[model samples]
Target chain A: MTSWIAGVDVGGGGIRVQVRTDDVGLKARDRGPVPRIAGAIDTSRLCGRIGELINSVVESGARPAFERIAVGLTGMPGLVRPAELADQLRLHVKTSSVVVASDSVTTHLGALGGEAGCVVSAGTGAIALGTDHRSTWNRADGWGYLLGDEGGGGWIGTQGIRAALRFHDRRDGGSEALLRKVEHQFGGVSAALAAIYNSPSPIHSAATLAPLVADAAHEDDPVARAIWVEAGRLLAESAFAAARGLPQTYSWGGRLFDAGELLLGPFRDEVLKRSPDAEIRPPQGQAADGALLLAARGIPAGAIAEPYVHEFA
Target chain B: MTSWIAGVDVGGGGIRVQVRTDDVGLKARDRGPVPRIAGAIDTSRLCGRIGELINSVVESGARPAFERIAVGLTGMPGLVRPAELADQLRLHVKTSSVVVASDSVTTHLGALGGEAGCVVSAGTGAIALGTDHRSTWNRADGWGYLLGDEGGGGWIGTQGIRAALRFHDRRDGGSEALLRKVEHQFGGVSAALAAIYNSPSPIHSAATLAPLVADAAHEDDPVARAIWVEAGRLLAESAFAAARGLPQTYSWGGRLFDAGELLLGPFRDEVLKRSPDAEIRPPQGQAADGALLLAARGIPAGAIAEPYVHEFA
Candidate 1:
């Protein structure tokens, strides 16, 4: 009997799963995130959903138990007990071992393909992690929207909206192009402001407007372009800061990089500017692929132990 | 019987009423703000509360109808219709005429003593209004905490906390003093951050930490002091911007100015730096006092007509 391995990427948007056995592989996604109860990961529900996703991805045959499973979760650190989550998974899926890690770790592995390097992942927020997966674990930013996440989507969107409002108010540094876009999207700046304030997740609200900024930047809007340029620089700074004791090899993962040269141009410029010998590479895969790699191959040599990467046998 | 006048200041903190008749004046306060329903002021509840406070401020006797009553409301501009509010006020208080003005207008009246100058009011938020009361109405930087309100208490507190978080993250520009204070106040920076994010009024939560920044600045913490300096400079810029085409005479209102030299020093420096002949005067009274002045003396000479200041007889 061929053994199967499963990988799960749990994020704010939803849950994605990958299954592999022999040379065949399959992927599936659930449009709902693991329900969090009062700041905690609902382990039972998460395991149940992970089981459903894994089953859906596997070919229709006699239901086969997975040999191992790995999960990269958004709110993993300090929010979930790995041992308990592993135990819960045992009840839902037939797996001999379970691995749990922060999405940052998975992102790092996915970006650098388990090689020692720095990876800055920016989506709704931004965080950089540098590790040899053995002893070093340097982190930068990811402080959320209020305090940090500086060069992330939330930051870029906020700057864009603020510039729009500046134009609306006829203040200096206002951008007419951005203002027109914002007015079209939110009816007016005041209404947009009100919507942001009243939003349950204000960070996401701000981040949702990031594409508008990118679009404006692409159109040669000076203020919007400046915002992206600054964002790239700030993200590079975070990468370098995280890369302190690590090698000068850097990469990035996350949808923010989807803007292509708009972000990469400045990000690459700053990284090389900071360290002339630095190497910048495109990501190998994604968080789910990294998680699947962990499940299929087990922990790589020099990978950090418990707390960062936990295993239950 | 000599006619009496009433002035009510409705703010986020609460409502305060001042009643004047003959040579005596009485004051009373209600610690609860006017109830808001679906983003609109509950005029009925507000009028009921205003009536109770007004009656409380008058000596126990036969209630004499007021000749005029002026209200300075925090959310008057768009949240409440002045005529509707006036009709509501008439039902609660036997007044022949009612005056309703934005807190900005009243703050201007109080700070400049009805003069044609500029006043910047900084509290939980900040705003600047410059009007001749007859024609000019140049306003600047009241865009709330999200977009504007730079240099306001909320802005100061946010910058302070951000520095603290940077320290916690071991990032550049971090302040040890601020980190220590934040940890002391909120047990930990992460906890403090969670609280702020979970707060219904995140701006107020940030503003509440302004005193900590102020204290740290007083202790000569460079980061905290720099924040205040920038804040003062920003406020001054707003003041000067509003003062455009008007007299360079300027004054300030709101408890934020109570920081005294810490704020006033940089504020005055920036104001003078922007305009050599600018005059910085101490505020003559509070917002309520301006509302009272409006009620007693009616609109000042050359004071701009309706919308800015409304009178229903």
Candidate 2:
């Protein structure tokens, strides 16, 4: 009498699907690009893509047919009505039981075992999400890719490239190493110019240069290194916004919750410099897992030992 | 005996060469990518390229036997030492007479008929140059493309995209047009993600979106139009900085300078609301022509008419 459930993570780039059953545990996982409908994608079309992805998982010969499906979407704005979103999803994937939540909610649930803590996702976009013991959720600064996604990979990458160009233009005497590395990665300034001017997705091309920034930071490129530090500071600012008002009983989830340390070293240092008692930890799972747990009817309340119970294949 | 002279204008994107002689008038113009030397381009290399360009005009058999070369560079920072820059130029072309000045200086010279006034260049970069009747020069906010460069086409384009993205994330119901336009231009959110992630020249790519912003503004997109208006305000801020003293006069230069009516409509409105006596006019000639005027020895002060001369072919 075990129930099967599906979880969908919709992002700006694509959609990911994960299915699970009590008997087999995590069953099928798949990913696909969100299809564009009517020359553009709306809520209905996006939900349809999610439905199609869920159907694909069902069709993949998994037993104990799913009784419920849960979807976690990263791209949907917070301003949208939750009830309306739920209705939209029902239109595409007709099911007696379905749950929809913010991708941040799921990510936090997965990372901290559905506990009361915060999660910061800094990929192409950036946002900080936190939930209190009473399930009061709050978010700050996922304003989308353009306005502020500050301290995200894209921001770091963009700032890095801008610094390299500035150093190139000003010849500030000690930027040869940075310029050389950037030129090599970008195939010289001419190619960089063409890619920037003629190409459609210039930001994507620029993001590839992120590693160069990281490398320069390691090699002590002042400008490049400074950008990372600044990124860390910004990331911390976003995280601090989410961490406010959380009870002292809710400590940050361990190792898995601490991924922010990777990009927010300077930010953490700065935060610690300001606040001596800050609870930061590494996250154990991801947003998809959180969505799956929510689908399975688990409301994470507090810290639990070895919380994530997914059967990895 | 009507000696000829060549003026070279080097910008962030490309370089332009204009040769002028008394008999031939303004003959022979060429445009090409800025040349790089030694697999890279430094300040010295850029100066050398300017000299070589001038030498090309001298060897091209343009009559009246050119006696001097004037080089104007838009992207160069403040003058550390003019003598050193002059010495760098002497390394390439054989000429007894060579003058190197900031492209802004020449732009102002041409824009204000070699008299005392302010000149603002708002292109890929932004700067304001000014001089009093005593020939004391002043500059405000041309800090390359990284720190400021506000009010330029690049800044406006970047702001437009940012605003569009913000409006998208806000889900405030008034940004469908802008979101659609951005998605169409950048080839969907995934491509935008990739570009922001992978490119080496994000600013350049951001700058390329200027036309799209302009188009959106033309269509009366509020966010897009706001970007242009904001740019005008920022440009006006630069003009204000230059016109700090009493009874200030200023001229606008750069490609965006001509977009005065469109970009500056709101900006001028805002400026007049604050500073009613700010005299702003479009420049007569470009930076290259300004360089020629700068290089021309002994042309009595105030001989050149206000608004200088406008010749375009």
Candidate 3:
């Protein structure tokens, strides 16, 4: 018997939630800001918010009770302890079982359904996850803004800002088109720096400029195109590393959705260079969709995935 | 005959000042943290402090009246406005002539003895400066810690910390020896993160660990050695760009002194590859000495080098 389930993508500013039921299929519910970062998560605050969200969904008669739930914390294993978080969240939501995992896991599950494949999620940060037919998963990179996050939206945006400043100063590696675009977007270099410094999330603030870079790429600006080319290569290389030569199919996911062949062209070339037979496909749905699959027991969570979201009590 | 003059390396934490006389050669007067970055400089406060320093030196019989003074502001040309700063300071100091320049220019001057050559100063940030025989100067990198500054102490330290974290997690590209060294250095990963997040100058805090990386390299840790190799190459490439293929000499300065050949070997090789006759030599004096040269009119501050430190009184 099919029953109700929910999937949540808890982010720094807010949480995006999706509810799925046998009769209703899948629908988005209310979204509210959670604490932030898988690592900086305030468990009590998050659990309380989860409880409120579940109550609102049920009180409004979205469903009588959720049979299962899945949560993809932005930083799962490294930042948030899946088992502990699952237990805390269970007390608030009515669920017989819950699956908790990294947002990367949800991305993979959502993009590939129950099929074996790799999903490379590139937003403010970038990470790659792959699973075999047996649902065993391997993950790579997402080292945040400093150490790594190569080729992600934030990386691109940062490069755009830096290049713009250099170009404005008539410094080397400066591009006129890029400088104009970044100046227009940021209202000037100092403003851009100010915004980044004053903002609560510098990474996300920078990521917002990725589109300007993407636009620059469209114009065939060599500087802009270079960033994308490097990004695509890095992303593909990282995703391939996670997949370990198994399940030759891959999906690209994240805010930099379908940057067209600009990103995909290099990504595809990089992947095919190694695997030759590798296929790059677009994800069918978002991470929430994958979370639903985990909730419905259509796929099992790996060791890092934390299959059980419900509290024992 | 040289008159009493002062040269100051206005640093982030404190001011390193040298009171120079025709007879004394070079004498360090006092040092106290002034400000961190160029943007953070408080003109009034700095000028007041400078006034006090001059008074202290005179009162202690170090000097009678300063005939000339040169101040090498850490981020003068880029982050700090040279003319405006010089004008503000002149109102407070007793000097007929004063010169102001980026610390990089002074670093080059001090290292090259007012001759045409390149100086790579890699401390909290990295920058290279070079001048042709005609005194036309060019600068490379030093784009601050965020944009660039590769091969600087801050960069090496940051790399060391990142490698340590990755190794601790047994993540991809981790080195066991590096991890052990990092853990011992920071007391643990959590402590390291705390130090970075809680510090006023995260960049400086990270830079503090560069010594640890050097130690690791001393023990032949692959990860630590790789960072130095990369750093050496980057510093050389940047210095080459600034030199414009003219000067065949280079002076490497900063806290990375203890790193020895682990850094200099690759740096020398890279520089020599570009300029086969290039000579790498130890710096004859510090930036303060360069400032003294500026004060004595021993070297003309290029158009790029603002040659006035006097405030419009």
Candidate 4:
């Protein structure tokens, strides 16, 4: 019988599950829209949904029975109440061992290939987390949607929309490009306003404006360009805050990391200006892979070694 | 028949009606929260309620029939649709004269004592508005809570609470003062979180944290003090943006003005570092008074020879 492990990455928009077995390697994978529970999903619901996802992956018969499971959650409202969550999951799925941690921890684990470094996640939300080899963990920002969470998709989108609206309100003909883009994207002020107030996830809808802002940056809209540049600066600031007490090497991961040069170029420029010796490394795998790696360690008291691998095969 | 005018200061929390009749001088005044149209008084309902408040002031038998009525609203969402709002009000009350402008406009009118200067309003929201003697209006910030509105009560409160939460999450053992203050004022983190999310108006609830932050600043909490000091600097930046095209003689109003030395001392010190010649003065009257002054002349055409008065009374 092949020993198997499962990892789940639950986020604001969706949930991803990955299953890994020694012989079959990583085979079963699935994703689904996040379940809406009145307001937002509480910890119990979150853990339950994650457990169900893990069961589905295990029942797919692509991998052997899971001996261990790890769940990484991004964009969670608060810090993981690990013990309570673990207890809740025990009722649903029977795994030999489980490890629950912030999606950030997994992101860092995957991004640095489970090495000692820092990872800055700038997606719908933004957070910076760092770990030294000696088990010291530091984090900055990631205060959720209501407060801070600066230098992320939401921030960029907000800045873009605001600049567009201000341009519309000015009537003095300053930001023609921005106004035109807003009109094109959101139809009119009324529609835009309604969409902003009435949307299920206004932040996500607003975040869609980020790419438009990036396009505008290319077209020389000073306000839009400034927003992107500032996002880079802020992301760098968040990274620096996390990197303060860490070693020279660090890594970054997130959906925004895919932007490669456009985002990281400015981010690197800004980070180097503040912290001269910082080194940036690419993530080895997705957050789910890191979680699976953690689960594979099987009730280890110390930090798991070889937590993430670049290639599943 | 004496020509009577009503000045209404409508805010998010409630509406304040100040009726000025030429015969009775300042006459009877009353205020109440807006009635719910469906189940809740949203922005539109609040605005409609403002119109109702103005009409109540006019028909409450406190003064003789008025030739014209002027109203000043403090918390208008935006100024693009004031004409539509005017038409709506015209449907309710049979008043020949009605002028609709931003609350910042009225506050500036009052701060300058009907003279032409600048007023920076830092209440639940923040905006800096300036008028040259030549009738050109310049504005800085005040893009609403979603956009900018920086240096206001909402901004300060939000930042202060975020800092407190950061201190709480750090577990670094310091920030005991901040933790105690948060527990005392907002209950625990759960209660504070609920109040922030579940309150009728999160902005106002956030604003409630300002005084506590002020106390913390007084107590020399470095983080708390930094919040206020940074708020002051941002307010000054907003002022500087408006003051760029105008002369040095400028006045300020809004609730933050009442804090006076406590708020402006640090604000002015920082502002003067950039602009040495700025002459700051107190507001002549409340925003409602400024609205009355404007409405007396006619909504669109009212032009005071001396818009700003040096003395309060």
Candidate 5:
């Protein structure tokens, strides 16, 4: 029987799991986000959640034990104890070999398929990583919503909402269409303001408005279109910054890119503006796939170091 | 015996009370911010805190009763119940006449002395109010930190911190001096990020760093100076927007203006850019002084309406 391998993606939105053998692969998702306690990853609950997702996807009669497992998560850098996560995953998934790393690393691997290039991921937040899975690892952005994440969904949505508020206040740079959309979406500007400021996860709440911006942009709203254009340029800057020493090949992943040409057209223009020789390609897969590949093949020699990626056997 | 009148400024930083009766004005202050519960003013606690401050300043043997009392408070618009606050305060300070109004209204009164001009108040947040204290009341900004409050202390501080983070990440728009100052101020970048993000009042925590940006600007850091320049411009824009239908006379209040020429230089330029005939002047006093003036004279005829200002006797 082919050895089974599992990969987990723990992100701001939720948890997703994939269990695969050479012959078949199964996927499952849970809406619960990776638990955070006092600004750090809740490793125990995260491992348990990953195990449950993986086990549910595998055959009921078959042993839930996996030969290898890899987990990629948000808020992992400097805050997560990867070894502890690996240890806990071993207890939960019955895997002898495991790898735990930041989602940025996995995103890079999945986008470039372990090649030495750059990948920018823009979901609720944005981050770029350039690595050969070895000694050359460069990162840009991902400083959280308050400090960075310039071109992410949170950034785009915030601009949209601010424009709406400007319209409500009769200030310059107001967007009437965006104002109507926001008022319709959140009942009223005051209610929207109250809800977002009082929200437990305000960044995510702001990010939920990204689509509203995109919709307005598609309708030819100048202010909304300008927001996306700027977002695309900023995201491109992030990708290029990470790709500094690496080959100029770049790819991207994340739901924010689902805005399609509205984001990509400007993103491509900015990338080409930076390097005429740059190669831009669609992502090969996603973070979970990268985790699965790492579990199956193990981290390449010198791909990463401690405090970034941890391994257990 | 002369009757006493009191003015209270309830702000994000704390509370201050000034009691006067023509001959003497005794001032008392409390570091406790106006209590907020569920995003609305905690009127009962606010009145009690004001009472405690007012009573502490009056002679123990003398009656604390005032002929009139006026309170200018943050978060008062659409949230505070003037009648309820009046009832509560009567039990505490024995006030017969009370006027409750939004801090924006009082800031304008304090800056322009109730003239028909615009006043921009820029502390942790920023707001512009243009009113004749009769029929026309024009407001701009003050949408809070997330959606608006542009050119405010929070905005300037956030830009300063963002520039520092960019330097840390070796990204474009980085400010080396600001980065050094921030790390020095907060022990390290990581600690600062954690503290600011996890703070109960993130906006105020961010605004606390505004002085650091000002310091860097004084040291001739281009990025820091640009931040101040932009802040000044945005503030002027708010003032102009509010002054649309009123006289082109403008003044400003709040601690943010303490940045001196670093802020005022550009602020004046922008105001003149909009109207070459504009008048810019120094504020006469603080918010508490405005409250005192209002208490002595009462809100002017057609100056304001319900939801903006409430009067009880």
Candidate 6:
């Protein structure tokens, strides 16, 4: 009865936390933004803050003897060192054991409720992680914006801007209407150009256009529609690449995926076309819930995807 | 006797100056590197240096009342302002008919010998310009490295690095050979990643791989060969787009084109496939000679291409 377990999902928009024990099913809370992968956030400061937040959520002593704590954060080990994060977390959080990982790892666990499957997390960036029943896992894309990020918002937005520029240059004369949509999205073409050309962190700025692209697509702009179509194909391609000869329970998760059918319709079509056995179902819970399952020792050792796990203890 | 008509073709590698009159044409001088477009180059200082070099070649007193001077400088009006060059030139020489223009326009003038044709200036960058018999002009794809530069060295090298990284990820099952080539080129896989991901001016750094990619292509690496093939197709597409409805005198002129048949064979096939009438011909003269034509009023007004012209006087 004294055992306590918790999970943390740290993302760009904000951080979400969940705590649970066998007697108590689950308790959850939502907070403001966390340090992004590599942008303006400091990992040490953020980790210490996360430790404080965990205490608040559990409503326990200053140093709760938690049985286990699992954290899924963006920028783990890629843009930021995983060891730095683990060392900082150990300094701040008092727990018998604490572990951190990529948000995609906890995503698959929470979304599938521990049943083996694949998940395509499409947000500012996109990554796909899949594990077969045998517990072997593989991942595709999500190499950040520089390398890849195929179907993510940043990718889609960049593609849209490229199309709009081509239309301005009269490459695709049919893209004039899309150009107007883009001009309107950024106040004007000049402003958009300035933002795109002059910005330091162009990925974040480009992602600001995702909503405009979605609306234009819904409005039947051929260029915009083409953007979503290619996005669907690329995202699915990433998923198929990661599925690695296994049946996949595919769940598309991300803020942009919130476009629902506007985005998922094409994504689903593309995913099913390649993997006829893929189950294009909705996610059962958010990433935080998956973290909760990890905290409570719900995920089996064999089923734990090692490719994504930065830490096991 | 004091009148001199001269053209200057300023590019990344070096500067070429051609001095001539109706009775005599002096051979052009190839000097050291000039200011490159969009790199760490100071325009005013470079312009003064160009002026000094021009005077030396003409064998005339400083501030000689030259009949006409036309300059084709890289980055002018794109990375550097045309006024900056003109103003700086005025400091070193006295010429009422001095005109500063983009290297691309001067390239087309020089390569075609003032004929109506498309010139694909392929180097660290790529730009295509075309003029019809009616004097109407069109340009395609020279938006620098960020937005475009599809067939340029930067594009080819970037694509190669991407392929190499994919091989590093073990994504391309058949890319082992290409990976070794990339490792050898960049001193190792780790250095390659650091150069690609950490360099401030990654375009220039990535372009350094162009030669390595060319060698790998010749060695029969499928991935490397694919890079060249795609480069050829994209460069040709840019030419075709610029040619518009007119019959184009297509000339591919740049340092990377120095790969001779290794680069041009595939490019020729692609260009000829789309443009059967495209006369695959070598440049009649170098860019400095083309600028000399501009200075001497050799370019006919009827077939003049002004889209790339930075100055008219």
List each model's interface RMSD: 1.9, 7.8, 4.1, 5.5, 1.2, 2.7
Selected candidate, larger DockQ, 2 vs 4: 4
User: Would you give me the overall lDDT of model 2?
Assistant: 0.60
Model 1 RMSD in angstroms: 2.8
> Residues B70-97, candidate 3, lDDT per residue (tens digit)?
7887755445666666676777766766
Tens-digit lDDT track of model 4 for A103-122: 88778777776677778888
How would the docking of model 2 be graded? Answer: incorrect
How do the residues B27-140 of candidate 5 rate in per-residue lDDT, one tens digit apiece? Answer: 999887669888688988888899888988888978756889999987756667778878888878887799988888888888888788999999999999888887788888
In DockQ, how does model 2 score against the reference complex? Answer: 0.07
Candidate 5, superposed: residue stretches over 4 Å from native: none
Q: Rank the candidates by DockQ, best first.
A: 5, 1, 6, 3, 4, 2
Q: What is the lDDT of residue B281 in candidate 4?
A: 75
Task: Identify the leading candidate in terms of TM-score.
Answer: 5
Candidate 5 local lDDT, A150-248, one digit each (tens)? 999999989999899788778889999999999999899888887787798787899999999999999999999999999999999888888888889
In model 6, the Cα lDDT at residue A313 comes to 58
Error of 2 at B19 (Å): 2.9
Model 3, clash count?
Answer: 14
Model 2 regions more than 4 Å off: A1-126, A129-147, A150-312, B27-30, B36-66, B78-85, B133-135, B171-174, B258-260, B298-313
B-chain TM-score, candidate 6: 0.88
TM-score of each prediction: 0.91, 0.54, 0.80, 0.77, 0.96, 0.82
Reference-based lDDT, residue B158, model 3: 80
Which is the leading candidate under lDDT? 5
Error of 2 at B221 (Å): 0.9
Q: Give the clashing pairs for model 6.
A: A110-A290, B110-B290
State residue B25's C-alpha deviation in candidate 6, in Å. Answer: 6.7
Task: Report the lDDT tens digits of candidate 1 across residue range B1-313.
Answer: 7789998888877988889988888898888956988768988889889999998777678688899999988764667889988999888789988999888888988888888999999998888888888889888878777667989999998899888877766667779999999999999876888788778767889899999999999999999999999999988988888888899899999889889999999999999998999999999999888888888977756667666688888
